[model samples]
Target: MAYRRTPAVQARLDAQREAVLQAAVVLLAERGYGGCSMAAVAERAGIATGSMYRHFSGKSELAVELFRTVVGREVAAVTEAARRESTPQRRLAAAVETFAARALRAPRLAYALLAEPADPVVDAERLVFRRAFRDLFAEQIADAVAAGEIPPQNAELTGAALVGAVGEALVGPLAAGGRHPDEVIPALVSFTLRALGGSHDSDA
Candidate 1:
């Protein structure tokens, strides 16, 4: 028979796992994926290197989890920013602004998430992350088209293109430590608005 963990033991393990992930986040922010080895994370979390295996099987697994943790927060922020806007164009702008602003605020972390070289597992998670943003933008684009705020277009394709555009536009700045947010963010927002073929007079 398999040995069963008691509730207390299980709770302890869960908390330990959380601590490991938190330590990994700090490492990722500071040094990207290269700095997030199990030993480094274990040291940061005040645990033995071997103990990390209790929470994650290896670096790839930990990297995927870390990517999810960071990306989840980003997605939520963009979603909330979009939710607060009344107009479709405004909602899309808000999402872009929020994403760009947050990325600038955390350049190293953003660089790691956006363009860092990492394991195939993390690359897979990155695709999922991009799709989430694409879908969010597609929803607003569809709305804008329905309301005649923008010309009829393929919302899904446009959404994916916008996601790629934003990511590519930010990659340079993110890699360069996110210089000139005031200039970069507004420029990005304006670009996104123009791409959607919507009026920017109100934003101006």
Candidate 2:
């Protein structure tokens, strides 16, 4: 059924969609995806269960949209945070801190983004996001190599390794009960720098 709306109605609909996403995140965080229900999400959004069906067809679509919404925010924030840092190491560090801090700020959202799996749409969206971050790291590594700050290596390989390392290093700490992000970011930065053949000034 086509649910066309006036401009004002459209705005309200958009707002309702965001609320659904938020509610879905809460549900996924509190109860794993298998346990969450569309009716529950609708209730959380303060909308009737029937109204949510107008926006999302099923559990998969709702979860995918939530994945896109929450993880997209993290990816965008990380990209923005690392924009000023030129060195590959610093850029990698910025990326790590961005993920860690954001994860802590939204633990359930972070879990849904990193640890949990969504539908096929979510998987495709995640792959696109992962590649974007990989490209960003590759660019930084290229710059660092150009400046003679690091050993020469294939940018893609280097980027993949760093991205993997970042995920491995931060995921546990971010998810660890009672763990704070500020404490982990510096350690993460230092470790990644060393893994990248250490900085130029470190040996002196």
Candidate 3:
């Protein structure tokens, strides 16, 4: 028979896991994936190196969890930004602007999430992260087409392309430590608007 954890023990494990994740976030922001070894995270969390195994099977597992934690917050932020907008075209612009602005604010972490070389597991998570943004863009593109804000187009393809374009556009600046947000963000928003074949006057 398998033994079950007591309520107190389960709560303790939950808190420890959160601490481990928090420590990993700090390390990822500072050094990208290369700096997030189990030992380093354990030291940061003030736990034994062996204790990390209690929360994660290995580094790949920890890295994937870390990616999800950070990406979830980003997705929520952009989603909220888009929700506050009054039009499909403006929603798309808001999403792009918010994502670029936040990424620029956290360049090292953004570089890791956007383009860092990492474990195969982390790479797979990156695809999921990209798809989440792709879906968000596709939804607005479809809405825009329905509202006649833009010409009819394949929403999925356009969405995927936009995601790729935004990622590629930001990679250079993010990797270079992203010094020029005021210039970079507006330029990106304009490019996204033109790609969607929508008016940028209101977004401006």
RMSD of each: 1.1, 3.3, 1.1
Supply candidate 3's per-residue lDDT for 156: 91
* Candidate lDDT (C-alpha), each: 0.92, 0.72, 0.94
lDDT (tens digit, per residue) of candidate 1 on 37-113: 99999999999999999988999999989999999999999999999989999999999999999998889999888
Ranking by TM-score: 3, 1, 2
Candidate 2 regions with alpha-carbon error over 4 angstroms: 1-4, 26-36, 86-88, 117-121, 178-183, 200-204
Q: List candidate 3 stretches off by more than 4 Å.
A: 201-204
Cα deviation of 117, candidate 3, in Å: 0.8
Best by lDDT: 3
For 42-68, candidate 2 gives per-residue lDDT tens digits of 888889999998799988788777766
* Model 3 lDDT per residue over 1-204, tens place: 999999999999999999999999999999999999999999999999999999999999999899999999999999999999998998999999999999999999999998999879998999999999999999999999999999899999999999999999999999889889999999999999888888873553
**Positional deviation of residue 116's Cα in model 1 after best superposition, in angstroms:** 1.1
Better of 2 and 3 by TM-score: 3
Cα error of candidate 1 at position 10, Å: 0.4
Off by over 4 Å in 1: 201-204
List the candidates' TM-scores in order.
0.97, 0.80, 0.97
